[model samples]
Target: MTTSDVMQDVLGVILGGGQGTRLYPLTQKRSKPAVPLAGKYRLIDIPISNCLNAGIEKIAILTQFNSVSLHRHIYRTYRRDMFTEGWVEILAAQQTLQGNLWYQGTADAVRQQLTEIQRSNAKYVLILAGDHLYQMDYREFVRYHIETEADITLAVQPVEAKLAAGLGIVKRNSDGQIVEFCEKPDLDALDELESMPDSDKPFMASMGIYVFSMEMLAELLASPGNDFGKDIITGVLSERRVMGYVFDGYWADIGTIRRFYEANLEMVSPTRPFDLNNARRPIYTHPRFLPPCEVYGAKLDQVLLTDGCRIYDAEITNAVIGLRSIIGSKVVIKDSVIMGADYYESEEDRTKNRQLGRPDVGIGEGSVIAGALIDKNARIGKRVQIRNLSDRPDETHQNWAARDGLIVVPKSAAIPDETVI
Candidate 1:
């Protein structure tokens, strides 16, 4: 098929309705897809940009929990003027006269929006997860599905033996035909389902990405099932011609707090697998025309400083300073992900905050923040310390919390001066 033909035949459906219980505090005010990433972009941008880069334009994002910010970001970033007969639309969970139920799982989310999906004039449907970080050419994936003549094609990744049990393991023959599948199998079950023989990475893990013939997908959704992994994929393996497409690229599911923190830190590494700097397929986001970031007498190493940041007499290393961040003098931040402020606080706003006995909108002077994630618009007062010293797996304070030994200050939270965690 020609590029135009492929573009016309494929519809991209992004599932963005998960509760994100693992990434709490960060997800306290926003959905998982709306969570900030790489100092600037939201997690949802990864999938949308991939679809746009692959020439798949008519996309639908399914959102449910805390969807206001996600909706705002989508509308602002993906403008209709940018494409011809192309659109990035949102399908939020709603209560209709027929039913008043919410999305129960991935498959159920799409099932609820089946009417809208059927309205699109596309032969195949490409379903993607919104919170995963990776760059993939969906055109190649779709072409592979067509070549295999598959009713359903799941994108799988080779993972180390240690990590195989946590994912859905797929066993495929040499022809890429999926023979067996198991979700979150035990060690013994994973041992039985190993697909690769010679390589160090012997287990094929599902990426939660699938391409399906429109007819097949509609028929599958007609049944009573909630999840694709736990329901549809498992049930249809015996009946349908299911295939697997191996993806040999940088892909990280930022589901848990540790994974989320590690993924953000990986972006600042000198030699990382995922490169956001690729001009050929750049990640798109809501454009904030803020001024350039300014660093004044600050010591920095391997830091990603986005636009509209002001650093003064601070020390930072292996950190990501997000947009519109303000770091005061004598501050020390290391191995941290500061999500930065949504908007710069005006002088009047600062005065009002002071009157209300609140610190300004960013990190304050002499504060030491290490191994942490400071969400957007947080206020850390002077001499505050936020290192998870006890290495506790989980703890919750007034406005701050610790998960997996990493301190997390939720969005717009205020920490008092000289407070220690």
Candidate 2:
């Protein structure tokens, strides 16, 4: 078949994440996929954009936990033109005659919606995680799967030993045929799981990106399995024509608060690991046609400042200031991800803020925010210091929390004037 025909035959399924407890309050009001990332875009945008860029137009996002926002985002951002046959749809888990429970795990999630997925009449199904950061061309991955006539192909990458203990380690033959798999193998088991003997990053880790032939996907879902890594992939390793497609690109699983915090900061670093602004491969999101960012004497060094921001004589370093952000004068924000407001606060909104004894929906003057993540619509008052001064690894307060010593101001959280954290 031609390349266009092959792409037409492929359907992409993105597994919208469950209750992100590790990501906690950031996910308190939204699903993992709906969680904000890199200032303007949400996590789900990554895989969807990758699919659209790779020519896979018919995509479905499986949602379960706090999925209203996710559904709304997909609806608003990914609407296809009237002339196009492409669509990005959401598949929510619900009660069925066969089962009433919500998805138990990754495989179970797909199994619950297998009938719906099959309705696409796709020859191949490409499965992707909703909450990952990377740029990939899936055409090459599908091409590899087709050329080798593989039943299933997993994108694998060599990761540092420190990261292997928490990831699915795979042992593949020289021909890239996957032979063994262990989910989150212990450090002691690394020797046997090493796909590369003496490489600097010895263990080959699964990137959680997979492409399965349509028949194989149906056959595998017949069994009772929860997660893909812990149950399904493990059970089929020795029996199936599974192969590993080695990927040497930047990929991150921002499943935890620390990883999420670090990943956002990395975007504003000098050595940016992943570039979200590639002209040829743009990351798509909802177009909020707000005015250009208004900056008056703001000293920004290594920052990702999005649209509709008003910064006045502030010193910002190594931060991702999101859209519609308002920073007052003398504000010092460093190593932070400031997810700005959902809507511009009118005079009435400021009146409500005054009644509640909170600042307006932005960072007030003379505040210092370091190593923190301030969620959208937060009201941080003047002289509020949020640097996690206690040095606690994990702690939860009323309006904020600390994970890995990074202060997190939850969505719509309010920090009063002169309050120090």
Candidate 3:
């Protein structure tokens, strides 16, 4: 089949079920996908926006753990009902013959929602991870899948050999067809692959984005398997004709807290990794009723603040402030993320949450906070210094502690003024 004649009816499915345990306190209240990004948008918005920009409207977000925030964000932001031609729906977990518990793995989640997929009448199924942050046109991938006439197609990119070992590694032939796929091979073998510098070979790594024939997906889902990557996908890769679509776009799986922080900081850079200036298809999110952000006595540079936020005498550099959040005098918020109160608070008492959105740590009237993450509704007392430079380079996940010099105050925690945190 030629690229021009490739099949076209593709349905986008986002797997948003992971507990996001790696993200700790951030995911402590909401799912990874529900985590706020660039101050105003949630992590899920990235993929949904990609789909929208790619011209794929029919999407299903499969979620489970702490899905309230994810569901609410989708409901408030995306209007599936408004679309006359397509739809976007959320599929939650339910009891099944497999078990009464939640989804077993990635494959199981899709299996549970087979009925919904059937109803969509989609010829191709595009599976994606909701926690990833990237901007790409999946239409090109779909076109590649149809042109190759393969059973499955995967979107892949090259990463540092050390980093690629942690993700699924693909060995492709000269024709760019997947020859072998392995998940997290040992460092020695990875080094061996890296040592052999093939002129035509590319260090293709899986982006956790896939396109599968409906028949192939159904067959794989019905088969007994604990995971798609470890069991089904690897099992099939060695047998069937699986193709790899090489991608060089900016892709970052915001799976860890530090990565999340780094990804946001990228936005403030002179040249951002991800392009937000695309006007062909704009990213959509929930509408806010609050007034524009009000900047008071603050020294701000290259920061993105949402509506109804008041920045007092504080230094906010390369950070994102959520909606209706109040920055107190001399409070410093730098290189971190602040989630909106609506995501963590109940509907009845959101005003209360809004009222508590300030420094929770006992940062004095003139304190400095650098490279820190503050939860909503925290009261930081005057003169509280929270700048810790001791961080492990190898680990992407870490907890906040006074010993580490990064004091994290939980939401709604009150700290008396002038008290040190």
Clashing residue pairs, candidate 1?
none
Point out the worst 10-residue segment of candidate 3 by lDDT. Answer: 394-403
TM-score of each: 0.98, 0.98, 0.87
Model 3 regions more than 4 Å off: 1-8, 191-202, 343-365, 391-408, 419-421
**lDDT of every model, 2 decimals:** 0.92, 0.91, 0.73
Candidate 2 weakest lDDT stretch, 10 residues: 386-395
Query: In candidate 1, how many Å is residue 294 off?
Result: 1.2
Q: Write the per-residue lDDT of candidate 3 for residues 256-351, one digit (tens) a residue.
A: 767777788887676897776679757678887776777777898878677777667888788777666666687777765554454323454545
Q: TM-score: which is higher, 2 or 3?
A: 2
lDDT of candidate 1 over 1-421, digit per residue (tens): 5966887889999999578989998999899999999989999999999998999979999999999999999999998884488889999999998679989999999999999998997888999999999999898899999988999999999999889888899998899999999998988777778788888998899999999988999999999899998899999899999999999999999999989999999989989778988999999999888998899999999998899999999999999999999999999999999999989899999999989989999999999999899999999999999886544868787799888888999999999898887
Supply the TM-score for candidate 1.
0.98
Worst 10 residues of 1 by lDDT: 388-397
- How well does model 3 score by local distance difference test? 0.73
Which candidate leads the pack in lDDT? 1
Task: Show how many residue pairs clash in every candidate, following the order shown.
Answer: 0, 0, 17
* Candidate 2, 137-252: lDDT as tens digits: 99999999999889889999999899899899999889999999998888788889888887899778998889998889999989978988778888998788899999999998
lDDT of 2: 0.91
